[model samples]
Target: MRKRLLTEVEGVVAAPVERVWRALLDDRPAYEMTTELGDHTVAYQGGWWYRGEWSVTAHPEGARVVLRVYNVADRLGWGVPLANRFFVGFGARTRQTFAEGLTALGERLGCPSRLLP
Candidate 1:
């Protein structure tokens, strides 16, 4: 079985993209925000990628802002493997983590907190 999770976060900042970008890309606030969001650390392993075994993507265009996250977790099961897989496939924990994490980030960035549809 294969499943994909997609989450989008969008907002507007009173400041310009450059200012917002600095606040985001610069280590100080970003690190603080990560910890506040329960993230252990935030690192850029590749272009436009934040590595902490967790992900958050920022797309800042003018005063508009967007963040997208894609998370994949493998759940391998033993003993009644099929049923266990199904149980893990549709669970609330991962969903809740994504929602809360994104909302907290948005709030930290001075954006209205919301869950994108």
Candidate 2:
């Protein structure tokens, strides 16, 4: 069987793109990025850093957001396979994580959710 490479999940947030971005990186170390307003996108590549993007668009009620996350970069280093098998187990429980994240984000942002897959 072929090994899984990436795990992607999409969701919509009721808040504005800027709000979503701010909430996403909240309570974390300071970081900066140059991004557009509506179609905002960001990437963090510190050893396969979830590497998620929150795509935002105008909606009648609120902005629609898509959160995509998965392993990115540094996949071919020494002992990488061993590490993935031993510690990371990448792609494992990705769907659950995505669903829980969106639900919590919706509640936190005061955006009603529609159940993520």
Best by lDDT: 2
- TM-scores, all candidates, are 0.34, 0.54
How good is model 1 by TM-score? 0.34
* Per-residue C-alpha lDDT of model 2 across residues 14-97, encoded as one tens digit per residue: 777677667765623255433323335554434433354555556555555555554444455444445656666555566566
Clashing residue pair totals per candidate (backbone < 3 A): 0, 0
Report the Cα lDDT for residue 101, model 1. Answer: 51
TM-score of 2: 0.54
RMSD of 1: 9.2
Q: Which pairs clash (backbone N, Cα, C closer than 3 Å) in model 2?
A: none
Query: Best by TM-score, which number?
Result: 2
lDDT of 1: 0.41
User: For model 1, which pairs clash?
Assistant: none
On residues 86-116, what C-alpha lDDT tens digit does candidate 1 reach at each position?
Answer: 6674234444655575455556666644444
